[model samples]
Target: MYRGTDLPSDGLIAVVKRDCPTCVLTAPVLGDFVQRTGLAVYTQDDPDFPETVPGRIDDTMLDVSHRLRIEIVPTLIRMRGGQEMDRTYGWDRAEWERVSGLTAIGPDLPMSRPGCGAKNIEPGIIEKLKIRHGETGLASRRIELGGGEDEIEAMFDRGWSDGLPLVPPTEERVLRMLSGTARDPQEVIGLCPPDLVPATVEKIAINAVMAGCKPEYLPVVLAAVEAVLDEPFAMHGVLATTMYVGPVVVVNGAVRRQIGMNAKGNALGQGNRANATIGRALQLVIRNIGGGRPQEVDRATLGNPGKYTYCFAEDEEGSSWEPLSVERGLPQGKSAVTVFAGYGLQGVVDQKSRDPESLSRSFATSLMAVQNVKLAPACDVMIVVCPEHERTFRTAGWSKQRFLTRLHELCEISGEELISGAKGIAEGGPDTLAGKMVKKFRPGGILIVRAGGGAGMFSGIIGGWAASGARGSSPVTKEVKT
Candidate 1:
């Protein structure tokens, strides 16, 4: 359903290319037909193809070929009252004569010959042609750069970068990135916060190209952005807060392997393209489309390094526990991205814990430092259980739920110790003559994801913003759409 160039209402149209052997054989005969009746000859390669023809339509740009839906060269078509009455491809002399109402169209030529593939349908050419013909429906404004301007620096000058050089989002690269998903480019995904700008599929593709994302990683980036824009995630609040936190994307299910995400050693570190680019793409979308820029709407006193990019895949293969997405209610084997308002990583090294009971106690003690040791129910936590630490629980036949429940139980403490001036530092929880017990985190405030090197005994803890649960920001998970 594309709008193409118009054709003659009443005429015999002959489409031929100089590169085709069959077209060369029938070129002279096509020229003879051009002299009789209302016959038009369209040449794809060269306008001088039929030397004897008086008028030749130069279709080197492929507008006419693509418009007429031409798949093969040397195609003869009959148009009556602006309607296609008949059409024939290749060098079939009998069929050409029948369509053109002419006898002995190519008497000296052989009976039939196959035509060459049309240039419009050549590999990777159609997308270019669609752009050239204004059929791509890409609505982003084109910023033509001056001859002296560098493409890389131009993006930085436009403030489209996150303190790093961005890949130029050219039309060719954007079109390639758009091929990753079946969704329409103009389709509006949601209104990004801070500025409340409408983010479209086309807009995301542009940012993805700038983020150096492969076409396949677009879905995970889209999912992360979708989760952020939701009401529960409170992206605007996360941006305005002085706490050190940003979107920590946890990829789960088959998409991790499909996109080659890093789930093993250095899973949270650099070196994986999917891991780095997917997170960067989400941040770039917020910056470029949503207008959430630093010192503007993104006001943070001491933002962590994860604010630039923070994304990783869970080691589903190494861990026997249910995936993090499964605990969040998404079914196993389905691809999803759960975004959490997480601060920077705090390493939890426990090399002596041999059993799940011992490990849970050690984890619970460390988890109390999410916001502050004395501040109970202040924040949430994402426990990245390394393979070695996860092995202890797996050997004891501890399910993910059982291990998490044990950690919660061990985190309970007397409310008297948490009251103001009780811990000697005076930065403690509320005190109304504290006499009861207090849990370190709110119910359902902790999440566990398996990642890191298989040999390491250390797990990472990413503390959430103090504003957790229904009021501020919650970890939101959505199924990844391919």
Candidate 2:
């Protein structure tokens, strides 16, 4: 089990076995030789075997046996310090004599195979592993900001970022952003996952700035960092999953207007800085502090563009129903952000439907399709109902609960509709929309909100596979900064 280098400068021979008659018979002679030569003697079954021997032995010997294919009894091992120098099995008297030579064991011996002997590792390989293990004392490494462009590029080339150009986080910039918030820069926001590195407000602001966020967006970013670190969120799993899940930020209250976030037409698309940067800022924090870079530990397959930026405001003014935050029991007029690890948007456009029932039916039919069924029924969904559709629902005198109830009823399908004949689908099932929906239907899975422009009769659905069950989807609300 011992590597050769783990041994003392002066070599020692250790005989190991548990309850073996041969070992018992040979103990006295071995003990005398050990005492005379001042060599270390170790027994496999001795209560204090590691202390008595030059080489340590434990359960790891079993691991070593598996690696080296050792399957014999009465093993005699030679060591210096705690490393194995040489080993022999089955009590070969000639081999024992050869190992017990007066001189120290030479590296030329047949047993001295690279790591087998106490060879020091190459410095370059050791350094690489240290970096991979995050043992560079990275936390202690001063956050240097003034590296030249070449140096910055080198850091990127060395696989440090999430495949985008970074805004150099100068000390001045970080401090200026920190000044926007009341929290201490050194105060720990939370430990980012995969690496479990401490995320200070200073670090968060630096990343937020890197993500092109304005100073006022710092509070929302801070709250998001806090929410993901909440034990239930399991940021580690979310960050590491092979699924295309990324954080979708939903903003509410007066902050939406103050920050100039888009809740109107193409809110999920581009053209709004506040919406884009807020979500981008959180993602940057996750990448920089949380260590969730794509393709490394991130491991997302067919990752969504939302991985870039997915944040939008609730269109409270256009909505006929209550806002999402209020539905989750937050007080009216409270500014908050609801974050979800979604697989991106599923656009539900129905320009032909004017009646509430027709619109609801269209949405339900779209939702019961194959892609929507990818999510578990118990999972929470964010339904972005456009103003045109909301107006139609209001004109029909349908409450939000009524819409939710109808949606739940319509979303249900039979087992045959769910099967896609793909590897993910259930075996021996029909491959229809009704079958798919029925297989994964759960009541109260829809989360409705009013958003988008008055021009289109379109809405969008953001669905998830599972509810994260007391762990995920507990939307955290933080007051937006002025």
Candidate 3:
């Protein structure tokens, strides 16, 4: 693997590209430096630059520029023993003269004209340069495509997609994604599901790149991965169950706004990159690394659209209650990701409810129907309170705990009503209790968060897996660390 070029032990290496106007203005100054001092001019774009000078090397390949870590055109470097001692960029008169040990360089020019960005710093160029220079220490296998092969079609054929076109996980992109977090790329977080594949930070970054995640979203994606892989989350069961369920990620704290996650107005729906990709990245890791596919380990009979990707941020700022992460035991002001085995979205419309009691009842009515209306404690639920709906609770001086307590109270039903064939509905609870009250959710089974737009008096309920509590997957929240 090519590392970088080694210049002479003692001399000045001046790097310039033809595209930069500053380099054009500074070309005459270069000829003077070469004649007066031990200088080697490396031209990034054109070799015939500065016709007045001889012995200038053409560095149009950018190998030397990348080797020297040049970020701007017209850069002057003083090298000693093949190591850079001093460097200066653009047309800074005094700075360039000092670096080159030459007097009055670029005297006719102004104080400085900021040089153009180096070619290696261009969007897709640096990655290629990194790969060519062999800087990335990625451990994943490299798959080179045929010259005639279509990259997009190739990924689908290889079963690497979740029914959507994915961003190619090129080495450069993966390396860029890894820059988001300070954790060692090779550091193993834990074993991923089904296949029990060891998941490393680098592997997760590869999936994050494929998921179209920006570098900043990598920490959140990593947190989501860790949360689901948690022993309590029961990710394998969630994937293997025939129930129409998948992981629904809820982000909280400062990260929501920092990553530009959608906390308002269609927060759960499409159009937000961070929301969509962070969720998708986790699934891709499960699919690619854990080998959990639809017909494979993931046996969801009729999966919801969220099986593709369902993630959103809680509207903590507009919420009347504490942030979901804080309520879940994270310290205030920190960021976290909570993963829940959720089935589908059920929205509750209560436009007329001006008070907490009325709205709470409306939410209870919809939540009670979860799994089955006649069943008792069948599944857990996640109630996403909208801004307008939360207003009703805040106006009535109801805390989040108070609202949840009332929801559990209102969800209580007679054991006789829940017993088999009580309401003419076949799906019902056992007949152990002849006349007793049964709670709709077990303790801590009801998860509530604030989301959605400001205008709508609506709230969403994500019904949890029927196998709730110690029996199945419960919500797992993990801190997002850099």
Candidate 4:
């Protein structure tokens, strides 16, 4: 069959038939040449074409036969200058070359032999064939380096980071980090917020490794991954918000002791490996996998330093009350992690408060004041009460539930107080279910936990706002297996 040749410099012809073994053998060889030369190639197969060859329709071959008579089962026809000149039949190793005018076929050419099928081919050649057939792989390549200073600086000048030198995530470094995870490299973890792009576990590990996380820290990273994936958490919205909300991780149970997470003085500040790296790992996962790079999807206005690394442990021993994880329905013996999308913390200093009511009032007021600013009244807040403050509540016979109840009572604010110019708090418009709840809860919706060193009278209040439409209220807790 003759088809108009628009570009004669790059074009060729291939002939074959259905159920012909020799024709089948030469088909792949011709296909390879057509791909390499960037030429047009079409096949003529018999009516009973095998089911093995893909994209082979009966109408196509029939149309070719109707246009041109093909008396032979296997034929090699070369078309040049808008005419078919060279024609050959049967399998002649030397004649096949003469008809096609191919001087030398590459040694790495992927061609099917007389008795071979596509399934029995080597992986490298199979990959080449698949690529020729238009199959695409994942875009997991590294950003090129070694550019001129101006070009390199241009990338940074675009507001890519927080003005600090970053560790380039090379493919080799990423692969090594992926070796620590048990999941398949291609398995999807969840969509990261703002962009809502799918992130595989391997990709998360790659960023984690680039963030300088040790292999042992992978589980904590994984747990944080699971925490963000929780629906209420709305990681996508959190990432996209202009608020300074960031993922704050709190380790509890045996994992804190195992990973040596800092739970005492300066726990939130830095200098501890586990505390720093675990939080950094999650940030990297968000930055790289979720594509929430700063100034892009992560639109935080004056983003807090905790965005770099904000992980700590609950001082279980120092507190007289139940640990945070246990109060959140986890068993005391089981290790767990809690993640909050929060703003910078406000320290609640209460040296004079010796009774539970006084300490609770101080914490409740701090939570309410912070809650009144940006967060919806229905949104949850984290109160990091120092161990000494917890001791006062314990000495006054306050149970964990009692403390939560007292804080809930003391934190209540009127609808009028909540309606005053809070950034994320939805105003009373038509009054939907969410709006009614926001008005009803006011400041009583705060979530409080006892943590930190026993010597300190200060507590840290982590404020949160509604993200992706509503507040992510549910705290996800997964037991860390030994």
Candidate 5:
């Protein structure tokens, strides 16, 4: 039942659009009906639909269309005392005749014709209409704009952007985004850092809408937010430092394919909506809800583009290794998201290293340059092995464990070259740490995931924020609670 107020009592309402062929065909019939019963007709797309009908209630703004949940145009409703008695959409001669009590029909009339889609449900209009009509219940402070004010500029003036244009978080779009989760709107997920604001589901949905996320992708975004907010992830420190660090999200399991994420070919770059917006939504939550903006709490010297968004799915099908989430203790087939305090991408190109040993050696050499060439055991690293490289390892019958072991072995460096005075550095390794071999990553600290296109011989690396252990951020994995 419609909860709207002020409905017509005991009347015939014909909802129509001029562009619909069915409405055009039945316009003459409706004209005759108007003359007979004095029907109250409404036009959705164009008000000047039927020339014979004297005036059409203009529904171009789609307030009436959305209120009544009209999916198809040319809908006829028989109302009695502010209540719908009967309703039918499109044109069916026998059905129309039975409902309208009219047997008259022109020879040009067909048996039946389907109506066009309602203008309210069009791609971008519904959300805006819902907000304009004040139908959705928004808890945030509403900003009233005058006729002279531009909304985009107003958003910029209010500092609600990440150095880019944002999708207006109208009440309707936020409400639609909230539909993705069954949790209560006011339920607190966690406390976001910097200002330590409590992030509710509704607030997260608002940011997700601003990030241009589809409703189906909201769960993954929510999980990614939760992952970053987890105490172990240490997002507050990640944002406050001067290191080139930000949250790098890795989505695993069925949710990756369910949301149409890009795991192949330019996966790290732009073009995929789910991969892009999900990451952007997390960043927006940190900025808008958490109060971590640049020059304030986010004191990075040179933040990377990944700070805007750096999310991608693993190519589980294309790889021989176990899925990242499964390796991280998530049940097989369950969807999960892991957040890492990652630096930026560093390409490791090795086209000629076909064998696993030689390839692992080259990868370890590139991994040495994470913080610096001499900086060993400084921080953990996320190795994104490309498909071509994965195939080379798979063909040689080398397991993921073997690859990691070989990489770890090759990454071990002598403390002699890492010391300060030996390398002529201002700050370097301790004298007690000199002359000893240091491993690149602690046990299980080396995070590896397979992604990217089949064409590239290059794998990628994302450096960690600080040394693995009590000092730096640790990766946190959370189940997607849809």
Candidate 6:
């Protein structure tokens, strides 16, 4: 055996994945070797591989896989004192005999079998691992505060805040925030747009601490971050566009009560810690971790106050309708967070409307004018039904589907009224759309959620960005799992 000076004194390590046929073929032989020589085994994929064996080290995160530069599974390497000595890949009986020094290691084994590709190097996994644990992991420059300097002022000096005093993210605070989940602190969540900086879990926790989020809010914040960063959400475009759009988050299921998020009266407006900070944490992630700052990466002409914080839980208990997450096809009772790219909230007031059809018509009337009265089929709308409005609909026994159908029907505009030369508005609808009752939203475009106080006959409309493809953002929902 060619023993290198750097080899670990700890004997040998066997790396394998059950999915590899070669690994499966070599497992019994390795088990035999383990009984004979006490071989240290690491399982990459299925931890239960070598079923009858014990003491299998898990390399599911691929940390050990990358450290050894493993390109093939079923790799047997001799090591001593943390240093590599000799290594062999696949199930070559002769090579195993040479490496393990075991005679007739596997009498029934085939002469040779090639190994499978290491899971570490497959597609996006390597890049993600590197970003998480490598030396070059964090790209942002660090800021050191002076002894006498106020931390808030320091944040202002560095332009690290969203024009408000932020909770200082000290090492202790960040560490405490990271305690909310068992995931590695350095695990990269995804890339933030605009600057396209990598958002690691630790970095997000740091921002979450700064956002005044409680430790329990960490999972929700993480899910919201994931929701927005999803490719379908088009977070990059949402931040870069001149539109008034920002992320609107709706929390559902057990997490709403677990985190004490306000899903009832004043849900959308304010006065809830979980609701407020959860949303704020995401914005801070984009601004600090993602490098999206107004006058910098973010170019919103007139951003709304919701930009500061725009998250609320659905008032599922008070409303007769199904929870937003349930309606969106998520399993009932599963906690989730849904993120939508939306402009500021436009209040839909119908104090006089006493019935479901009338209230829905009022909503359709107001929704028709979103972005522009003529912006039909161009954007989607999220209708937040207040408790009072929800009662009216429930009393009338109107399903969400029925209400949406009526709104879609009422949103159609006459072709002549929408065309270029009409209404003295140059940015008119196309001639091709003339004389047609163009639906305002696409099929299933209207999003509905029940929230707010029981007193007022008021609902809310959150206008969406452009259409739902590459040019615009589609809402994304992610289950919040601790």
TM-score against truth, every candidate = 0.81, 0.64, 0.88, 0.61, 0.78, 0.70
| Model 1 vs. true fold: TM | 0.81
The all-Cα superposition gives candidate 1 an RMSD in Å to the true structure of 5.2
lDDT against the true structure, per candidate, is 0.88, 0.66, 0.88, 0.63, 0.85, 0.83
Model 2: weakest 10-residue lDDT segment is: 112-121
lDDT tens readout by residue for model 5, 154-174: 888889888788899877778
Instruction: Assess the local accuracy of residue 16 in candidate 1 as a C-alpha lDDT between 0 and 100.
Output: 83
Who is ahead in lDDT, 2 or 5?
5
Tens-place lDDT per residue, model 1, 1-482, is 22444577787888888899888888778778866776788888887887767688888888888888889988889987778899999988888889988886678889888888987777466778778777778899999999999988988888899999999988878888888898899888889878899989999999999999998998888889899999999998998888888999999999999999999999999999999999999989989898888888888888999988999999999688999999999888999999999988888989999999988988988887777777887788999999999999999999999988898898888888888889697988677739988888888998999998878799989999989989899999999997
Tell me the lDDT of model 3 at 190: 78
Tens-digit per-residue lDDT, 353-426, candidate 2 = 87889989998887765254543344666788989889989999998999988888877655554455544655
Stretches off by above 4 angstroms in model 1 are 1-65, 68-124
Model 1 global lDDT (CA atoms, 0 to 1): 0.88
**Model 3, position 444: C-alpha lDDT score:** 94
Residue 136, candidate 2: Cα error in Å is: 25
Predicted structure 4: lDDT: 0.63
Model 3 per-residue lDDT at 44: 84
lDDT of 4 by residue, 418-458 (tens): 45343455643232323333432334345566666658688
Taking every candidate in turn, the Cα RMSD to the unseen true structure, in Å, is 5.2, 21.9, 3.1, 16.7, 4.6, 11.9
Which residues of candidate 6, in runs, are more than 4 Å off? Answer: 1-143
